[model samples]
Target: MVIAIGFEGSANKLGIGIVDTKTNTILSNCRRTYVTPPGEGFLPRETAQHHKSKVLEVLKEALAEAKLSQDDIDVICYTKGPGMGGPLQVVAIVARTLALLWNKPIVGVNHCIGHIEMGRNVTKCENPTVLYVSGGNTQVIAYSRQRYRIFGETIDIAVGNCLDRFARVLKLSNDPSPGYNIEQMAKKGTKLMSIPYCVKGMDVSLSGILSYIESRAPGWLDQGECTPEDLCFSLQETVFAMLVETTERAMAHTGSNEVLIVGGVGCNLRLQEMMRLMCDERGATLYATDERYCIDNGAMIAVAGALEFETGQSTKLEDTFVTQRYRTDEVFISWRT
Candidate 1:
């Protein structure tokens, strides 16, 4: 069996996973998250430290759970880019060291492509218009001519980043995640307060909406004009609407009947419901994976990297570098026909 090991430390979470490509099965997935205090965001230096401290333990767990020895690993893969520089560098260094120590070939997988490939593998959705939403990236993608083409994207801050900032404003708990807390609060919201909906043709702008909400949220709560629940509710409705609308448009443009949502924010039930409604209206199918696959994890990197390796793709030690601004469409989708 062709076994691949992947390392991921793009953001706050550090994950390692083993995948058996010949059977399309995940052998093991292990992770550790660097969660900050309420109203605080994780800094790159500290996050990288967390990864450095936990990386070995996580790797050991992954190997033990997979019941595999180092000799059984056919290749090593690491997330190459589209993530925080410090965290990405930590993972790259670990992956590089392991690759050399084990005398195995190494591959650098794009972070966005990892999410897309994992979503497809878990959901079994073929050729769907993908709506990838997360803290660092946002885009509507569809495959064509061996490329995941970007049809729409954020012109400003990402939707998840907007939510995270708002969560800080409200001093929400970061135990699980800021966005999950927002979704829970939104469920209790009875009123839909006015929030700006900024959609620029195919692209969406979220910074303005976040600014408007952040400016009014304090006054709204102090004056009893609205509750935190209401604010969360209004924010979700407005932003998710923009996402759904753009995804629908992409579906129409691509003539695709399938819609797949990936990335952290895509785990929100409200967003899934909104997209499902839209898909129903258009007689299309909505495909989504739960938190396990939606959240950043090493399994995704393994899956994507294994695909590239099986198709004769490998990155030399000198070429294994990371970038924070890797775009979704930049990589050539070699495995896809």
Candidate 2:
């Protein structure tokens, strides 16, 4: 059995996880999130600092939880791209250091593929349409020609970024998360205001919607035209509908009957409910995980990296660098047929 440990700090969350590739089982998954105060968003510099400070602690906790040592770990994995540069660097440096110290082979993984692999493994879905929604990414993908082809994606800001910026406008708490707080308030909302729905072809646009909402938020609140809850509800309904629309289009095009949602925003219950409804309508199965696997975590990286390693893929020490713009479709799928 090959045991792989993964390091992930692509964004605000820093996580370490150990997985056994033979059994497709996660031995340990640990994480720490950097949360800003209400009305504030996390800057890349501050987020990177947070990861640097907490990386060792989280790594130790994961190893202890897994009851494993360097001797037992056969491979080490780290997210290499498609994230904030500083945060990615912090994790990459740590991963490199660990690999050198332990004298083990290392694999650099793509963050999005990490999520896709973990989602498929956890849900046991053979070939499903993937809706990967996160703070920095939003895309509808499917496997084709040994690559995860992107059928649809946001042309402007990502859906999670839109929600987060909107939360800042409302001065929502970032304690647990801005998206989570918005979801709670939306549940209490009784009215749905008219919000713009922008889905162009296979791509969706969310920046304009956020801008439109921001411009009218003060006026709507001051005039008592709508409550915060109502606005949140409207925003969720509109954006999620756009997402569902594009996802369905991809499903139709691919003729896929399974849908798997991944990433931080995938933790939203409302999003899941909408996707579930769409799946039910089309007789497709909807597969998703809770915060553990949904939000960014180390296990996903370990799982993906393990797959890469098993397929005879390993990053040379010279190529262990991180990038901020690694596209999911750029990675060659050596393990997948």
Candidate 3:
């Protein structure tokens, strides 16, 4: 049994996963979320602090669940960049220390690529165009030349970020994550309220819609005109439509017949339905993974790391560093070799 351990502390979430390479099974996975104060902007230092404090607990929990120990692990995998520098650094330190202590190989995986690779592994999709929507990202991606290329992305704020900000504006519960609350609200919504939908070329503009929703809050509340559920449903419909459109366009442009949805937002059933409908109409297949592999987790990282290690892609202590904002195109495909 080839056991690989993965650590992800890229955003406000800390994750650890253990995978068995031989069976391609996730033995254990755990996630701990850090809260951001209401009305406060994202602070990298605060995020890092949260990771520093809770990562150990999460790691221990994952190991216990997997019924394994540090001695049983073959390699350590950590997210290298395209995330908050502070949080990334915390995980990087843990990964490096463990690798050195165990004299094992350490692999640094790209956060976005981890999402994509996990999508591929779980869905078993062959060369599909991926729609990656998360708190920090919204992109249409395709893998080529050993790297995942960004075919289209948000021109402004990410889709998940937009939803989070909107959720905050409505005084939605921040606990258990705002996205989950929005999803619950959306289910109760029956009315269709119009929201702005803007997509320019391959990129999208979510900031504008966020602003529009905020401005109309007073009016919507005063008249008892729109229930929170209605608002949630409309928001999901508009934002998800834009995502589906962009993904379809990418699929068309690339002449790819398959679509795979990944990332945190990909767990939304409405979004999945939209993409599935689009693919069905186009005579293509639509693949989506469950929450276990869809959200940022360690199992995906372990699986990704095992693949990278097999291809001789290892990170050096001197070279490993956190990047608050790394581009997807910056990763060179070392796995294909």
Candidate 4:
């Protein structure tokens, strides 16, 4: 059986995973996230250093958990692009070193493709319009003509980044995740305050909304105009509504009934419920991975890279470079017919 080991250190999260090529099952998944204090964001340089220090330990744990020797792996896979430069580079260097050390073939996988492939694997959703949402990315995509065509996306910052920044403005906890805490707080919200709802055609602009909310939030809280819970509720409702509308539009354009949500923010029950409502109204189905697979993790990378390797896709040492601006459509989907 073909087995592949994947390393993912795209941002603050460092993941090491192993997967079975034939069964498409994850054998082991180990991960660590570099979390900053409340009201702070992680720096790329520091996050890179953290991953550098932790990758080896994480790799050992993953191998032990999987109960497999390095020699049992057929290939090594690493996330190559569309992530923080420093973190991506650290993983690339480590992956290349492992490739040479283990005498194994190396494959580079797109981070976004990793999420999509993993979402498909666990959900068994075939030919669905995928809504990929995370701290660094937000896009509505559909597979067509050998590629995942992006129909709509955030024109400015990603949806998760917007939420994270907003949560920081409110000094929310960053232990599990800012988004998760915000979701819980929003549940206690009874009042739905007014907020910016910006959706321009297929793309959404979140910076303006974030600015507007941040500016009004302080005054509202001081004047007893709105509580933090209310603000969180309004923010989630507005942003998630915009996302659902865009995804529904993409599904209409592609004439697809299935919608798959992936990435860290995809774990939000509020967002999932909103998507479910729209899908139900349209007589469609909604698919999403649980928090474990939904968030950034090595399992996603392993799944995508294993498929790439199984289909004879491998990267030479010289080409195993990481990039920060790789677009989703730039990748060729060779594993699928």
Please report the candidate that would top lDDT against the real structure: 2
- The list of candidate 1 runs beyond 4 A from truth reads none
* Whole-model lDDT, model 3: 0.86
Model 2 misses residue 163 by how many Å? 0.4
lDDT of 2: 0.95
Q: Model 4 residue 54 lDDT?
A: 96
Q: Relative to the unseen true structure, what is the C-alpha lDDT of residue 309 in candidate 4, on a scale of 0 to 100?
A: 82
Distance (Å) between predicted and true CA of 149, model 4? 0.2
- Residue 242 CA error for candidate 4 (Å)? 0.2
lDDT (0-100) at residue 230 of candidate 2?
95
Residue 32 miss distance in model 1 (angstroms): 0.7
Candidate 2 C-alpha lDDT tens digits along 1-337: 5899999999999999999977877999999999999999888899999999999999889999999988999999999999999999999999999999999999999999999999998999999999999999999999999999999999989999999999999999998999999999999998889879999999999999999999999999999999999999999999999999999999999999999999999999999999999999999999999999999999999999999999899999999999999999999999988
- Model 2, residue 58: distance off in Å is 0.9
Q: In model 3, what lDDT does residue 247 have? A: 92
Separate clash counts for every candidate: 0, 0, 0, 0
Q: How do the residues 136-245 of candidate 3 rate in per-residue lDDT, one tens digit apiece?
A: 99999988887788989999999999888888877777676788779989999999898888999888999999999889977997899989889989999999999999
lDDT, residue 261, candidate 3: 89
lDDT of 4: 0.93
lDDT of each: 0.94, 0.95, 0.86, 0.93
Candidate 4 lDDT, 48-167, residue by residue in tens = 999989999999999999999988999999999899999999999999998999899999999999999999999999999999999999999999998999999999999999999999
* Cα-based TM-score, every candidate: 0.99, 0.99, 0.94, 0.99
Better of 1 and 2 by lDDT: 2
Question: Considering summed lDDT, which 10 consecutive residues are worst modelled in model 1?
Answer: 1-10
